[model samples]
Target: MPISSPRPPPLLMNLSLRSADRVSYCADMASKLAMDKRLDDFVMILESNGSDLSVLVGLLDARMVSAGICGLICEGRVGEVVRVFRLVEGLGIGAFELCDELVKAVLGLELRRLVEEGELGEVEVEVEVRRVRERLKRQVVRSVEHGGVEPTAGFIRR
Candidate 1:
Protein backbone atom coordinates (compact mmCIF):
# COMPACT_ATOMS: atom_id res chain seq x y z
CA MET A 1 0.00 0.00 0.00
CA PRO A 2 1.28 3.46 -0.85
CA ILE A 3 2.03 5.66 2.17
CA SER A 4 -0.48 8.54 2.42
CA SER A 5 0.98 12.00 2.73
CA PRO A 6 0.00 13.97 5.85
CA ARG A 7 -2.91 16.30 5.28
CA PRO A 8 -1.71 19.80 4.39
CA PRO A 9 -2.12 22.43 7.10
CA PRO A 10 -5.13 24.64 6.57
CA LEU A 11 -4.32 27.73 4.52
CA LEU A 12 -4.37 30.99 6.38
CA MET A 13 -6.95 33.25 4.88
CA ASN A 14 -6.31 37.01 4.55
CA LEU A 15 -9.05 39.30 5.69
CA SER A 16 -10.53 41.02 2.63
CA LEU A 17 -11.91 44.12 4.33
CA ARG A 18 -14.21 46.21 2.16
CA SER A 19 -13.67 49.92 1.60
CA ALA A 20 -16.40 50.77 4.08
CA ASP A 21 -14.69 48.59 6.70
CA ARG A 22 -11.36 50.30 6.00
CA VAL A 23 -12.94 53.71 6.44
CA SER A 24 -14.55 52.65 9.71
CA TYR A 25 -11.27 51.26 11.00
CA CYS A 26 -9.50 54.53 10.23
CA ALA A 27 -12.19 56.57 11.98
CA ASP A 28 -11.92 54.36 15.06
CA MET A 29 -8.15 54.81 15.19
CA ALA A 30 -8.50 58.59 14.92
CA SER A 31 -10.96 58.71 17.81
CA LYS A 32 -8.75 56.55 20.00
CA LEU A 33 -5.75 58.74 19.30
CA ALA A 34 -7.66 61.89 20.14
CA MET A 35 -8.68 60.46 23.50
CA ASP A 36 -5.14 59.30 24.25
CA LYS A 37 -3.74 62.72 23.45
CA ARG A 38 -5.44 64.26 26.49
CA LEU A 39 -4.26 61.50 28.76
CA ASP A 40 -0.70 61.87 27.48
CA ASP A 41 -0.71 65.56 28.37
CA PHE A 42 -2.14 64.80 31.80
CA VAL A 43 0.66 62.31 32.38
CA MET A 44 3.23 64.93 31.49
CA ILE A 45 1.69 67.36 33.96
CA LEU A 46 1.84 64.77 36.72
CA GLU A 47 5.43 63.91 35.90
CA SER A 48 6.44 67.54 36.35
CA ASN A 49 5.68 67.41 40.07
CA GLY A 50 9.17 66.11 40.98
CA SER A 51 8.13 62.73 42.29
CA ASP A 52 7.73 59.23 40.94
CA LEU A 53 4.34 59.77 39.36
CA SER A 54 4.31 56.45 37.57
CA VAL A 55 1.89 54.99 40.09
CA LEU A 56 -0.55 57.85 39.60
CA VAL A 57 -0.14 57.59 35.85
CA GLY A 58 -0.93 53.88 35.98
CA LEU A 59 -3.90 54.51 38.26
CA LEU A 60 -5.17 57.18 35.90
CA ASP A 61 -5.05 54.75 32.99
CA ALA A 62 -6.97 52.17 34.98
CA ARG A 63 -9.62 54.62 36.22
CA MET A 64 -9.94 56.83 33.11
CA VAL A 65 -10.68 59.76 35.41
CA SER A 66 -9.62 62.23 32.75
CA ALA A 67 -12.33 60.92 30.45
CA GLY A 68 -14.91 61.53 33.15
CA ILE A 69 -13.63 65.10 33.61
CA CYS A 70 -13.80 65.72 29.86
CA GLY A 71 -17.36 64.41 29.77
CA LEU A 72 -18.45 66.59 32.70
CA ILE A 73 -16.82 69.68 31.20
CA CYS A 74 -18.41 69.04 27.82
CA GLU A 75 -21.86 68.68 29.36
CA GLY A 76 -21.27 71.75 31.57
CA ARG A 77 -22.89 69.90 34.44
CA VAL A 78 -22.58 71.77 37.72
CA GLY A 79 -22.98 68.89 40.17
CA GLU A 80 -20.46 66.62 38.45
CA VAL A 81 -17.83 69.31 38.38
CA VAL A 82 -17.17 68.89 42.11
CA ARG A 83 -16.64 65.19 41.67
CA VAL A 84 -14.18 65.82 38.86
CA PHE A 85 -12.26 68.26 41.02
CA ARG A 86 -12.19 65.76 43.85
CA LEU A 87 -10.78 63.10 41.57
CA VAL A 88 -7.92 65.39 40.68
CA GLU A 89 -7.36 66.30 44.31
CA GLY A 90 -7.39 62.66 45.39
CA LEU A 91 -4.60 62.02 42.91
CA GLY A 92 -2.41 64.45 44.92
CA ILE A 93 -2.87 67.29 42.45
CA GLY A 94 -3.92 70.69 43.81
CA ALA A 95 -7.32 70.68 42.18
CA PHE A 96 -8.73 73.76 43.86
CA GLU A 97 -5.95 76.12 42.76
CA LEU A 98 -5.82 74.64 39.28
CA CYS A 99 -9.59 74.91 38.86
CA ASP A 100 -9.45 78.51 40.02
CA GLU A 101 -6.90 79.37 37.34
CA LEU A 102 -8.71 77.43 34.64
CA VAL A 103 -12.02 79.13 35.38
CA LYS A 104 -10.33 82.50 34.92
CA ALA A 105 -9.07 81.47 31.51
CA VAL A 106 -12.54 80.26 30.54
CA LEU A 107 -14.16 83.45 31.72
CA GLY A 108 -11.56 85.62 30.06
CA LEU A 109 -12.35 84.04 26.71
CA GLU A 110 -16.07 84.38 27.33
CA LEU A 111 -15.70 88.01 28.32
CA ARG A 112 -13.73 88.71 25.16
CA ARG A 113 -16.46 87.09 23.07
CA LEU A 114 -19.14 89.15 24.81
CA VAL A 115 -17.19 92.37 24.25
CA GLU A 116 -16.73 91.54 20.60
CA GLU A 117 -20.46 90.96 20.08
CA GLY A 118 -21.57 93.82 22.41
CA GLU A 119 -23.84 91.36 24.19
CA LEU A 120 -22.95 92.52 27.69
CA GLY A 121 -20.87 95.20 29.37
CA GLU A 122 -17.43 94.28 30.73
CA VAL A 123 -18.55 94.83 34.34
CA GLU A 124 -21.58 92.57 33.94
CA VAL A 125 -19.57 89.75 32.44
CA GLU A 126 -16.88 90.00 35.06
CA VAL A 127 -19.40 89.93 37.90
CA GLU A 128 -21.25 86.93 36.51
CA VAL A 129 -18.11 84.95 35.73
CA ARG A 130 -16.62 85.67 39.14
CA ARG A 131 -19.85 84.70 40.87
CA VAL A 132 -20.00 81.40 39.03
CA ARG A 133 -16.34 80.70 39.61
CA GLU A 134 -16.60 81.35 43.34
CA ARG A 135 -19.60 79.06 43.64
CA LEU A 136 -17.74 76.30 41.85
CA LYS A 137 -14.71 76.75 44.06
CA ARG A 138 -16.80 76.50 47.21
CA GLN A 139 -18.46 73.34 45.99
CA VAL A 140 -15.13 71.76 45.14
CA VAL A 141 -13.64 72.77 48.47
CA ARG A 142 -16.60 71.29 50.35
CA SER A 143 -16.31 68.05 48.46
CA VAL A 144 -12.63 67.76 49.23
CA GLU A 145 -13.10 68.66 52.89
CA HIS A 146 -15.98 66.21 53.36
CA GLY A 147 -14.20 63.38 51.63
CA GLY A 148 -17.16 63.07 49.30
CA VAL A 149 -15.15 61.11 46.79
CA GLU A 150 -15.14 57.36 47.09
CA PRO A 151 -11.54 56.46 46.54
CA THR A 152 -10.90 54.69 43.28
CA ALA A 153 -9.79 51.06 43.65
CA GLY A 154 -6.84 51.69 41.39
CA PHE A 155 -5.24 53.52 44.31
CA ILE A 156 -5.34 50.40 46.43
CA ARG A 157 -2.64 48.07 45.27
CA ARG A 158 -3.27 44.35 45.61
Candidate 2:
Protein backbone atom coordinates (compact mmCIF):
# COMPACT_ATOMS: atom_id res chain seq x y z
CA MET A 1 0.00 0.00 0.00
CA PRO A 2 1.27 3.47 -0.85
CA ILE A 3 1.52 5.97 1.99
CA SER A 4 -0.59 9.08 1.66
CA SER A 5 0.27 12.55 2.84
CA PRO A 6 -1.94 13.99 5.54
CA ARG A 7 -4.17 16.88 4.50
CA PRO A 8 -4.15 20.20 6.25
CA PRO A 9 -6.99 20.84 8.67
CA PRO A 10 -10.00 22.51 7.06
CA LEU A 11 -9.78 25.40 9.47
CA LEU A 12 -6.10 25.91 8.69
CA MET A 13 -6.74 25.77 4.94
CA ASN A 14 -9.55 28.31 5.19
CA LEU A 15 -7.46 30.64 7.34
CA SER A 16 -4.52 30.44 4.98
CA LEU A 17 -6.69 31.18 1.97
CA ARG A 18 -8.24 34.15 3.73
CA SER A 19 -4.84 35.50 4.64
CA ALA A 20 -3.69 35.18 1.04
CA ASP A 21 -6.79 37.02 -0.13
CA ARG A 22 -6.07 39.84 2.25
CA VAL A 23 -2.48 40.12 1.01
CA SER A 24 -3.69 40.13 -2.58
CA TYR A 25 -6.19 42.86 -1.91
CA CYS A 26 -3.58 44.95 -0.18
CA ALA A 27 -1.07 44.31 -2.93
CA ASP A 28 -3.47 45.36 -5.68
CA MET A 29 -4.45 48.54 -3.91
CA ALA A 30 -0.91 49.33 -2.96
CA SER A 31 0.24 48.82 -6.54
CA LYS A 32 -2.43 51.22 -7.74
CA LEU A 33 -1.37 53.81 -5.20
CA ALA A 34 2.23 53.36 -6.24
CA MET A 35 1.31 53.87 -9.89
CA ASP A 36 -0.46 57.06 -8.93
CA LYS A 37 2.77 58.17 -7.23
CA ARG A 38 0.94 58.49 -3.93
CA LEU A 39 3.83 57.73 -1.64
CA ASP A 40 2.17 58.84 1.58
CA ASP A 41 -0.92 56.79 0.84
CA PHE A 42 1.35 53.91 -0.10
CA VAL A 43 3.01 54.16 3.28
CA MET A 44 -0.37 54.47 4.96
CA ILE A 45 -1.47 51.16 3.46
CA LEU A 46 1.78 49.71 4.77
CA GLU A 47 0.78 50.28 8.37
CA SER A 48 -2.02 47.81 7.67
CA ASN A 49 0.65 45.13 7.22
CA GLY A 50 0.46 44.46 10.97
CA SER A 51 4.26 44.32 11.10
CA ASP A 52 4.40 41.37 8.74
CA LEU A 53 7.09 41.96 6.12
CA SER A 54 5.68 39.34 3.77
CA VAL A 55 2.52 41.33 3.34
CA LEU A 56 4.70 44.30 2.56
CA VAL A 57 6.58 42.24 -0.06
CA GLY A 58 3.35 41.33 -1.81
CA LEU A 59 2.59 45.03 -1.99
CA LEU A 60 5.63 45.65 -4.17
CA ASP A 61 5.30 45.82 -7.95
CA ALA A 62 8.47 46.28 -9.99
CA ARG A 63 7.45 49.23 -12.15
CA MET A 64 6.19 51.15 -9.14
CA VAL A 65 8.55 49.55 -6.69
CA SER A 66 10.10 52.96 -6.24
CA ALA A 67 6.91 54.21 -4.67
CA GLY A 68 7.29 51.71 -1.85
CA ILE A 69 11.01 52.49 -1.60
CA CYS A 70 10.45 56.24 -1.46
CA GLY A 71 7.72 55.98 1.14
CA LEU A 72 9.86 53.81 3.39
CA ILE A 73 12.93 55.95 2.77
CA CYS A 74 10.92 58.92 3.96
CA GLU A 75 10.08 56.88 7.01
CA GLY A 76 13.88 56.46 7.44
CA ARG A 77 13.90 52.71 7.00
CA VAL A 78 17.02 52.07 4.96
CA GLY A 79 17.59 48.50 6.08
CA GLU A 80 14.07 47.41 5.32
CA VAL A 81 14.32 49.05 1.93
CA VAL A 82 17.56 47.21 1.20
CA ARG A 83 16.02 43.92 2.27
CA VAL A 84 13.08 44.44 -0.05
CA PHE A 85 15.38 45.56 -2.85
CA ARG A 86 17.39 42.40 -2.50
CA LEU A 87 14.22 40.38 -3.03
CA VAL A 88 12.65 42.41 -5.85
CA GLU A 89 15.37 44.24 -7.76
CA GLY A 90 15.90 41.21 -9.97
CA LEU A 91 12.36 41.60 -11.26
CA GLY A 92 13.04 44.83 -13.07
CA ILE A 93 13.68 48.03 -14.00
CA GLY A 94 13.13 48.06 -10.28
CA ALA A 95 16.79 48.55 -9.39
CA PHE A 96 17.10 51.53 -11.72
CA GLU A 97 13.92 53.10 -10.45
CA LEU A 98 14.93 52.44 -6.89
CA CYS A 99 18.22 54.30 -7.40
CA ASP A 100 16.53 57.25 -9.08
CA GLU A 101 13.98 57.56 -6.32
CA LEU A 102 16.70 57.26 -3.73
CA VAL A 103 18.49 60.27 -5.19
CA LYS A 104 15.34 62.34 -5.32
CA ALA A 105 14.45 61.40 -1.79
CA VAL A 106 17.92 62.14 -0.49
CA LEU A 107 17.91 65.56 -2.13
CA GLY A 108 14.50 66.35 -0.73
CA LEU A 109 15.58 65.27 2.71
CA GLU A 110 18.79 67.25 2.46
CA LEU A 111 16.93 70.36 1.41
CA ARG A 112 14.61 70.01 4.36
CA ARG A 113 17.60 69.60 6.61
CA LEU A 114 19.16 72.78 5.26
CA VAL A 115 16.01 74.65 6.16
CA GLU A 116 15.98 73.62 9.84
CA GLU A 117 19.72 73.30 10.38
CA GLY A 118 20.59 76.39 8.33
CA GLU A 119 24.20 75.83 7.29
CA LEU A 120 24.42 72.81 5.04
CA GLY A 121 26.22 73.09 1.72
CA GLU A 122 25.35 71.77 -1.72
CA VAL A 123 28.68 69.94 -1.87
CA GLU A 124 27.81 68.01 1.27
CA VAL A 125 24.47 67.01 -0.16
CA GLU A 126 26.09 65.98 -3.40
CA VAL A 127 28.67 63.93 -1.56
CA GLU A 128 26.08 62.12 0.48
CA VAL A 129 24.01 61.27 -2.57
CA ARG A 130 27.12 60.10 -4.38
CA ARG A 131 28.04 57.87 -1.49
CA VAL A 132 24.63 56.25 -1.54
CA ARG A 133 24.87 55.77 -5.32
CA GLU A 134 28.23 54.13 -5.01
CA ARG A 135 27.03 51.80 -2.29
CA LEU A 136 24.01 50.70 -4.26
CA LYS A 137 26.13 50.18 -7.34
CA ARG A 138 28.38 47.90 -5.34
CA GLN A 139 25.45 45.95 -3.88
CA VAL A 140 27.32 46.17 -0.60
CA VAL A 141 25.22 46.76 2.51
CA ARG A 142 25.31 46.44 6.23
CA SER A 143 22.28 46.36 8.49
CA VAL A 144 22.24 46.99 12.18
CA GLU A 145 21.35 44.10 14.47
CA HIS A 146 18.53 46.23 15.83
CA GLY A 147 16.93 46.46 12.37
CA GLY A 148 18.34 49.60 10.85
CA VAL A 149 21.00 50.71 8.37
CA GLU A 150 24.51 50.90 9.69
CA PRO A 151 27.17 53.67 9.70
CA THR A 152 24.80 56.61 9.24
CA ALA A 153 22.67 56.11 12.34
CA GLY A 154 20.11 58.38 10.70
CA PHE A 155 17.66 55.62 10.04
CA ILE A 156 14.83 57.26 11.92
CA ARG A 157 11.14 56.35 11.73
CA ARG A 158 8.17 58.49 12.49
Candidate 3:
Protein backbone atom coordinates (compact mmCIF):
# COMPACT_ATOMS: atom_id res chain seq x y z
CA MET A 1 0.00 0.00 0.00
CA PRO A 2 2.20 2.73 -1.33
CA ILE A 3 1.20 6.03 -2.92
CA SER A 4 3.46 8.80 -4.16
CA SER A 5 2.87 12.54 -4.18
CA PRO A 6 0.73 13.40 -7.19
CA ARG A 7 -0.04 17.10 -6.72
CA PRO A 8 2.98 18.53 -4.96
CA PRO A 9 2.64 21.20 -2.28
CA PRO A 10 1.91 24.54 -3.81
CA LEU A 11 4.52 27.30 -3.92
CA LEU A 12 4.43 29.82 -1.10
CA MET A 13 2.17 32.84 -1.37
CA ASN A 14 -0.16 34.76 0.92
CA LEU A 15 -2.99 32.50 -0.18
CA SER A 16 -1.97 29.85 -2.62
CA LEU A 17 -5.31 28.09 -2.92
CA ARG A 18 -8.73 29.53 -3.54
CA SER A 19 -12.33 28.28 -3.86
CA ALA A 20 -12.30 24.47 -3.91
CA ASP A 21 -8.55 24.21 -4.52
CA ARG A 22 -8.07 24.93 -0.83
CA VAL A 23 -9.99 21.88 0.23
CA SER A 24 -8.50 19.76 -2.54
CA TYR A 25 -4.98 20.64 -1.43
CA CYS A 26 -5.76 19.80 2.15
CA ALA A 27 -7.36 16.52 1.16
CA ASP A 28 -4.27 15.62 -0.86
CA MET A 29 -2.18 16.39 2.18
CA ALA A 30 -4.45 14.20 4.28
CA SER A 31 -3.98 11.35 1.79
CA LYS A 32 -0.22 11.79 2.03
CA LEU A 33 -0.38 11.78 5.82
CA ALA A 34 -2.60 8.73 5.72
CA MET A 35 -0.18 6.95 3.39
CA ASP A 36 2.66 7.76 5.81
CA LYS A 37 0.52 6.72 8.78
CA ARG A 38 0.88 10.16 10.32
CA LEU A 39 -2.39 10.60 12.17
CA ASP A 40 -1.09 12.98 14.79
CA ASP A 41 0.36 15.37 12.22
CA PHE A 42 -2.87 15.61 10.28
CA VAL A 43 -5.01 15.94 13.38
CA MET A 44 -2.88 18.77 14.64
CA ILE A 45 -3.22 20.57 11.35
CA LEU A 46 -6.97 20.11 11.33
CA GLU A 47 -7.35 21.10 14.94
CA SER A 48 -5.50 24.31 14.28
CA ASN A 49 -7.32 24.91 11.00
CA GLY A 50 -4.35 24.19 8.76
CA SER A 51 -1.70 25.22 11.26
CA ASP A 52 0.99 23.07 9.70
CA LEU A 53 -0.66 22.95 6.29
CA SER A 54 2.01 21.06 4.42
CA VAL A 55 4.37 24.05 4.56
CA LEU A 56 2.27 25.81 1.96
CA VAL A 57 -0.49 28.02 3.29
CA GLY A 58 -0.12 27.60 7.02
CA LEU A 59 -3.24 29.43 8.14
CA LEU A 60 -6.58 29.85 6.36
CA ASP A 61 -10.18 28.70 6.48
CA ALA A 62 -9.09 26.19 3.83
CA ARG A 63 -12.58 24.64 4.08
CA MET A 64 -10.76 21.39 4.94
CA VAL A 65 -14.02 19.49 4.36
CA SER A 66 -12.24 16.89 2.27
CA ALA A 67 -9.26 16.61 4.63
CA GLY A 68 -11.45 15.98 7.65
CA ILE A 69 -13.44 13.36 5.75
CA CYS A 70 -10.38 11.71 4.27
CA GLY A 71 -8.74 11.58 7.68
CA LEU A 72 -11.76 9.74 9.06
CA ILE A 73 -11.65 7.21 6.22
CA CYS A 74 -7.94 6.69 6.76
CA GLU A 75 -8.47 6.27 10.47
CA GLY A 76 -11.27 3.74 9.99
CA ARG A 77 -14.04 5.98 11.27
CA VAL A 78 -16.84 4.69 9.08
CA GLY A 79 -19.86 6.15 10.88
CA GLU A 80 -18.42 9.62 10.97
CA VAL A 81 -17.49 9.39 7.29
CA VAL A 82 -21.09 8.83 6.29
CA ARG A 83 -22.31 11.54 8.65
CA VAL A 84 -19.87 14.07 7.29
CA PHE A 85 -20.25 13.05 3.68
CA ARG A 86 -23.96 13.71 3.72
CA LEU A 87 -23.42 17.14 5.21
CA VAL A 88 -20.81 18.18 2.66
CA GLU A 89 -22.79 16.78 -0.22
CA GLY A 90 -25.36 19.54 0.12
CA LEU A 91 -22.91 22.42 0.15
CA GLY A 92 -22.71 22.71 -3.68
CA ILE A 93 -19.26 24.19 -4.12
CA GLY A 94 -18.59 23.47 -7.78
CA ALA A 95 -14.83 22.75 -8.05
CA PHE A 96 -12.81 20.23 -6.08
CA GLU A 97 -16.07 18.70 -4.94
CA LEU A 98 -16.18 15.24 -3.34
CA CYS A 99 -18.43 13.25 -5.70
CA ASP A 100 -15.62 11.48 -7.60
CA GLU A 101 -12.75 11.76 -5.13
CA LEU A 102 -14.79 10.20 -2.35
CA VAL A 103 -15.29 7.06 -4.41
CA LYS A 104 -11.57 6.73 -5.12
CA ALA A 105 -10.50 7.34 -1.54
CA VAL A 106 -13.02 4.90 -0.14
CA LEU A 107 -11.89 2.25 -2.60
CA GLY A 108 -8.25 2.94 -1.82
CA LEU A 109 -8.55 2.82 1.95
CA GLU A 110 -11.10 0.06 2.36
CA LEU A 111 -9.99 -2.43 -0.30
CA ARG A 112 -6.32 -2.63 0.73
CA ARG A 113 -6.94 -5.12 3.53
CA LEU A 114 -8.91 -7.49 1.33
CA VAL A 115 -6.21 -7.38 -1.30
CA GLU A 116 -3.43 -7.98 1.23
CA GLU A 117 -5.23 -10.87 2.90
CA GLY A 118 -5.66 -12.61 -0.47
CA GLU A 119 -9.40 -12.15 -0.44
CA LEU A 120 -9.54 -9.71 -3.36
CA GLY A 121 -7.44 -9.63 -6.50
CA GLU A 122 -4.83 -6.99 -7.31
CA VAL A 123 -6.13 -3.51 -8.12
CA GLU A 124 -4.64 -0.30 -9.45
CA VAL A 125 -3.37 1.29 -6.21
CA GLU A 126 -0.42 3.02 -7.80
CA VAL A 127 -2.52 5.76 -9.35
CA GLU A 128 -0.52 8.72 -8.09
CA VAL A 129 2.67 7.89 -9.95
CA ARG A 130 1.02 6.89 -13.20
CA ARG A 131 0.39 9.90 -15.43
CA VAL A 132 -0.41 8.97 -19.02
CA ARG A 133 -1.81 11.33 -21.63
CA GLU A 134 -3.74 10.40 -24.73
CA ARG A 135 -4.59 12.43 -27.80
CA LEU A 136 -8.28 12.95 -28.56
CA LYS A 137 -10.15 12.15 -31.78
CA ARG A 138 -12.48 14.45 -33.71
CA GLN A 139 -15.29 15.91 -31.69
CA VAL A 140 -18.91 14.81 -31.57
CA VAL A 141 -21.81 16.58 -29.87
CA ARG A 142 -24.97 15.31 -28.25
CA SER A 143 -27.46 17.03 -25.97
CA VAL A 144 -29.47 14.99 -23.56
CA GLU A 145 -30.06 17.21 -20.55
CA HIS A 146 -30.66 15.21 -17.42
CA GLY A 147 -31.09 15.82 -13.73
CA GLY A 148 -27.98 16.67 -11.79
CA VAL A 149 -26.53 13.92 -9.62
CA GLU A 150 -28.93 11.27 -8.47
CA PRO A 151 -29.49 11.60 -4.75
CA THR A 152 -27.54 9.08 -2.73
CA ALA A 153 -29.19 6.57 -0.41
CA GLY A 154 -28.31 8.90 2.42
CA PHE A 155 -30.89 11.37 1.15
CA ILE A 156 -33.58 8.72 1.29
CA ARG A 157 -32.99 8.34 5.01
CA ARG A 158 -34.27 11.88 5.41
Q: Pick the candidate with the highest lDDT.
A: 2
Q: After superposition, how far is residue 105 of candidate 1 from its true place, in Å?
A: 3.4
Candidate 1: stretches off by over 4 Å: 1-51, 54-71, 96-104, 107-158
* Full ranking by TM-score: 2, 3, 1
Candidate 1: C-alpha lDDT: 0.46
Residue range 1-158, candidate 3, lDDT tens digits: 88976775544531566735655566556545533435445444344433343333333223454455555666655444443333333333232343347645664667676567764432232221221211111111111123333334123453
Cα lDDT of model 2 overall? Answer: 0.56
Q: What range of 10 consecutive residues in model 2 has the weakest lDDT sum?
A: 90-99
In TM-score terms, which candidate is top?
Answer: 2
lDDT of every model, 2 decimals: 0.46, 0.56, 0.43
Query: lDDT at 115 for candidate 1?
Result: 70
Model 2, residue 39: what's the lDDT? 46
lDDT of 2 by residue, 1-158 (tens): 99999999854664555666767766666677755655456555655666454555644674565555566666655444444444344333243443345546664685576567764454356556766887864443545444555644554566
Which 10-residue span in candidate 1 carries the lowest summed lDDT? 54-63
